[model samples]
Target chain A: MSQYIPRKLTRLPADYCFPAEGDVAAYLFSEEAVIAVEVALVTQRPLLVAGPPGCGKSRLAETVAAVLQWNFLHQTITSRSRVEQLTVDVDHLRRLNDAQRAARPEARTKARALERDEEYYNPGIFWWAFNPTSASRRGLPANVGRPRVAARCGGVVRRPDNQPQHTVLLIDEIDKAEPDLPNDLLEPLDRRSFGLPDGRTLTADPAQELLTIITTNRERELPQAFLRRCVSLLLREPERDGLIAIARVHEPKVAPELIERIADRMVELRQQRVDSGQRSPGTSEFLDAVRTCHDLAISVDSEKWQQVERATLLKPMVAQDEPSRRP
Target chain B: MSPAGGRRGEIHLGELISALAGLDCDDAAQAATIAACLGFGLRAPDLAATGAATPAIYDHNRALPPPAARRSAIPHPPGLALPASSPAVEALPAQIVPSQLASVGVLPSTDSSAAPAWLVAGYQRLASERSSPPRQTLFPERAARGVLTAALARWRPGDAGADLDLDALVRCIVRRRLPQCLPRLPSMTLDNGCQLLLDYSESMVPWWEDLRELARQVSGVLGAERTSIFDFAASPAGARRWRADREAIETWQPEPGRPILVATDFGIRGEPPCDLRGSGWPAFVDRCAARDCPLLILIPWSRFFWPKNLGLHPQLVHWHPATSAALLRRQRGLGHRTAR
Candidate 1:
């Protein structure tokens, strides 16, 4: 039997905004990246995305979560980040304070009774993704009364009368982490279950597999073993049409012609930088330049437009050896 | 004792007895004693006897300090002394007051050109500065990114667009270009000790300062204690250990078991470097091998200025415009290998 389950293509809600940035809406994904995401979903493996900086690698997870209506958990990987931080961390200081309060003679009787409770234990994203009620029961400040409930059916999270919510774990900048970190994720990625430092095992429901997306800028080489467990895709700089589409998503109010011109100029500038052995500008820079032009009402041929281009598109102090001669 | 006082004392005595009994785990007896302490008509024989035995509980009321004595014992905060008299205020002249401020220059004059010429000139200068855009100095990491992305085209293996490991290429570009954009060196610590030898000869005059800065950055990243610096001319005879604020040339000697980094433009004035030709190159390589020290040649020249014979040396590593100390520290092993 084929492992892939049929999932209806759900159009994003018109008013849907990414959880991280409430003002920005999800951008249209390229056909190739969409297929790669689908393959990752069907296989129930982490999607490892390799790309240049600001190429929408991190935003891919947020877009996916928004479209699927799944809870998004983002963690930016740094060199000092430890594996335990991804699971859970006990608030020892708070617990110690409680202990001290309990020993006080004038302490309230009720307050002393609650000192031994689990309120002092801080739950990480994995804890919430696996057992949503654990957060509600612990009376975590983040989740006070109402608990998040959604059903995970065939790797997609759907709203149900009463069911567990699925989560999308975004491991961003995985290359910045220690070499062993990718390998260390083997057990968690394979079993979809990890034991907390507190000795409690958090296992995902077999029916609803947790979706994970990892992004890398190719700063460091990830171990082969870890790569084997993931479905990887390289997100190259999109083609001209794709770049225009992205720009439109960022500034839909701008004229399409103007956006196209900006995108084309950005592409040319990137090519020039490439030829000169310099790094090329990414989609974010293109979006910024377009937005600045639109806000300032600066025409492409105007003198002030050159200032905007310099401020956003080109690196400073590097002489534009050749003037933009394009009419 | 008065009847009311006697009754109140008896109740207190009974309550204390009940607490003691409760501590002893006599639940039934404790409850009965509590009921008797409530002054109910029921007078249990055991309650009366317990109350009598616990006369010390009634002693609490007797031991209380008299109200007058307690009030006198209560400590009071020290009183703050107020100033004896307020100083007389010196009033400003009536003409200087806001109501009579016609002489004061609080408001703009009717004549717009009343301002001093220098003040007007300064305002004009400020306005001109504000109108003009500031010079752009690209962020080091951003510039590094630009170089890496551009270099990607060259590193791309085929049209399939499969994810390629560009870690080495990225290190090369970042190690070369970062020094130009970064004002200061990045601090890092390396496990293995190394020495940095810079080419300070005449031919490298153009890139001398930049190469020296790169060396200092590399030293900081690799750790200063473990990393040493030296200067070399065209020949081994011109090699000398680097001393701060000094140009004295001494006999060159290699530290055993430590890696050596030679930053140069690979150009020798008048004649080619002695080590690049004849048995001198082989002999130098043998000496480095004998001491178990890896020799890394860093050519601090941009890709545009790359010479045709750059790749001839087995230990030579060409520096690009995007080089950074972090990348150097990361690619130390590759630096030890032959430059391709």
Candidate 2:
């Protein structure tokens, strides 16, 4: 009997929202990361993230969406980021649906439109996550009822509960945004609803909390009021073990001996400080070394290490250092 | 050629000559056809504005990379549970110990006005309140950060004696200023508006520094603090001395209560497009708007005098010869030249 009931074999074509579950926690470096995700989910608050660049801050939002299987909304901030241009105009989608619904001939089919409401108007990533219709896991019915049956049954089956259970909102590299931008999230972060001047209140669906996350490279400092809302987690340069783990994730076929050998040397060099103590290498620097070694097909031992160092690490740094050496 | 004469020496036929010159003059009878074409066609209004002398270009200063995380000698001691909203930055006392404050020559009774001001008064006002230093310094590492920020902001193109006029014109369009002083096109018409494209790029490096210093001074005057001059006389390994205004770079966090002055440039050429839909400028604008940042993007310059992408975003303001001249004039200490 259970088998007789039609079941969805495939996920309806919804937006892919999160990154894989294991990756987010690893990248984010906090338990509160998920809880903050939950808070963003429940309260519909915009997530604010801060950290140095190359820390995988932007990737966390995508991981959340992939884990949850919801729509992923992404916006990357830059020095030129401005107000009134943040969200994509989802109004066009609403208008398209409206026109489609309007063209229906039957009064009862038209009545279905009135019943569902304009939850579709929410646009952008926020709209995808917060709009109830967007969050509805159920796809549109496969077959339309006959006109006589539609008249009797009112053309559409209206679900009493249409709220989304999950949504991921990703604001990437928020620090790159103009200075005023990060603090501006206070209201949206707190209320989970932004009031459109058009007299309509757009809200994240209550059942599915709006999971918002922001990332920054610390190019500029964000306002404290904006920073205080979330649990602050710093993603330091990954240690030797972490770099090994990252290399394994990217190149599973690479031998463990090779991975361990590469990680050990990279870690040792990174730990070395100049007399002034300023020669620290970042996770990015380490990763570049790994890629360089792989491209050169160099073995893990010291003989080929110089080639990796020359190609990936030393040249760029020396080139950068050359001009500043001027008297 | 007369500096002020219309094209071909027929001042009255300026529009006709401009029309013939501009490739985008679609309509033969349109009044602004020549102007629009010349505006888009002339590569560097600033360079054109300057008759001969070019300003030097300098490489923009790079910010120091983020420091690695380490265990603090004294961790953020567990007892301090910060409230949802901390006290206003000014109302909050310096968390530094009394000895440290004394060592720094800060008196416990220092007035609120004792805080240092920005390099520019307008910039000071535009800086979010959080960026303003409190009477007491809370973070010990702030001094280094302050110096780092100032140095980074001071980075500009090299002073290669490139003509500032073209650079200035390019910078103007890249900055995207409009309504105040619109961009000019070189139409044949007597009023083609190309004359307004005076070159000032040669003076840009000094102009930029003067402006930054002026801003620092203006903010300093209001706060009763004297601006300290930083010197660059050190040898490669010699001890470099930096004078940081604890009030400026250290305290300047972007705040809602204050306007943000975001400096952006189109570069000598535009940056690589971010996404498929020409996300370069539009993406930047949208993201800032979405995050609620009151962004003021400053297109400091363009590699070419004229760029095809100049008119895309409306909020942009291109730095005009008049504007650069005005800014230079205001900073007279730099001995900036006036428009002839």
Candidate 3:
């Protein structure tokens, strides 16, 4: 009577993110992007998204989670971020603090609670994504009841009416961390399971297939072994019509003529940037231009348009033809 | 050699074949148009009757450089944009037979006509893969894990601080002694980014792509800003790198304590390459050693095939696929911390 597969994206939705807390961004997926995402899901491998900054590589993960009605969690990688921090981190400082206080005779109950390693174990993004129910209990045995809702951690997720079945874990700008971090991460990723400081190995639920999306700014080359495990995808810059559609979606009230003019100007500015071998203005800048035009009433032919262009599109450097000092 | 085993087509025919089922054979013009954009030379006996010219591969992604900018002598890369409009705009009614059309992974019709008409972009050019050269080094990804980075990141010993020293914190907590400043308990950092000297001389024509890949690998482990990439003509004594702030090629002055990585052939290229005897490479090595800068020269030759005259001061690594992080660590004497 019915032929439908659950949690499969057939077409790009008009607005990928929905009516949730701070989920208002629009995402228009290209066919190639859809294929890459599908391949990753099918292969059970993490999707390594590579693209210029502001190309919505990060947004794609959030959108995918929303479309599938899956719980979404993300971790931002930085220079200081380590492999241990991604899966699970033992709060040594908190443990020490508690230890100092619990050493006193007055805090006998607190000292007993501190004895359990589960109290100090903080679940990382992977842990939360793999099994939120388990992570909520802080690596305690299944006999332990689910912790209070207050124990539920931070991350943007649109609550589904039904019980959540899957999670989309996004590790953003993976290349930002030291080269060792990624290689160290491969084991946990491949196993779909990780170890806790309390001598516990928590594996992903067999029924729930966790989708991990890893986005890199491509600041450096990720190692071969690490990359080999990933289903790769590259997001290209939006074309002329795509930009106009994106502008209309971002700023619906703006005049169509104004949106067209802003889009064209953005294209020209991007062309100039490409010619100079610099990063071109992306969709975010285009949206900013559209919003600025609507708010300031700056027409393309008007003198104020150049100022808007300089402020939103061209970035720091002035175009060579603009002035003498630029030379 | 037989055609099936030795030769490969410009476009994989199997991909085109599977695409025929989705097409409307009645609209022969549309099918032919698709075929043309796909770089297919459909010389059907019936198609030729329509006087339609065969479409060559339209590489509008600008894969080649401009004729005037071409530097044939130095083997300069011809930039990534595909070259010239080779796709025939004329459609063929005769070649529209479904029997003729058979290829796999055809271009999805969702692509606007305005997009590059090729089957796929260079990043996804698995359909038209170029035969690799004799010596192919990893480009997109280098090393297994962070071997290369581990070897080079060592000598450039980073600042006095790293991430929070968990061991120190645990010790302090057990000893019941707290430091004045919490942040002072950071660990000793590994990684002092290196200066990369890339040789773009005519002698390095064969390994130009490898050199580019080398830069990407080094920059990957060490942040691009930390890995100062400079273009060297031959010797690193007076190399030049484009300063983004200045928008000009400025002399590369190596910083002290920062490890130096030179991807050069010691200015000698032959069947059995001559050693770095008379070249200024010896002087360059000596100069780097004096600056307390650990030097690693990545030669695109086989192991033990480089000049032995320069002494053991500069760590020489064969820039080949066989080279791994473990090998790099052993070569650089960073084996003490090697996970292998």
User: How do all models score by TM-score?
Assistant: 0.46, 0.40, 0.66
lDDT of 3 at B124: 52
Worst 10 residues of 3 chain B by lDDT: B47-56
TM-score (chain A only) of candidate 2: 0.63
Scored by DockQ, the top model is 3
Give chain A TM for each model in order.
Answer: 0.79, 0.63, 0.87
> Per-residue lDDT tens digits of candidate 1, residues B1-340?
1111111211334433433343332445433432332333253222101100000110112233333534456666789866757688988877853574357658755986887898777663335445656432221322332222121111111222221224543464467532222121121212234556667668988766555555444433332333455566665324555222122223456666556666676674434333354524455556666776667666655444443432322355455555553454344432221211
Q: Which lDDT tens digits does candidate 2 get at residues A1-327? A: 011110110221222112134433323223324433433333233455544345566666665566555556666765444333342222333433454456667634555543332323223444444553532311122252222111111111112344344555667776554335555555455555554434565555455545567765543445545554443334446667777876666565677777787788776665543222233555666667776667667876668788777665545454334111221
Error of 2 at B256 (Å): 30
CA shift at B235, candidate 1, in angstroms? 10
* Candidate 2: residue A110 Cα off by (Å): 23
- Order of all candidates by lDDT, from best down to worst? 3, 1, 2
What would the DockQ be for model 3?
A: 0.19
Each candidate's DockQ score against the native complex?
0.01, 0.01, 0.19
Q: What is the TM-score of chain A in candidate 3?
A: 0.87
Candidates in order have lDDT scores of 0.53, 0.39, 0.64
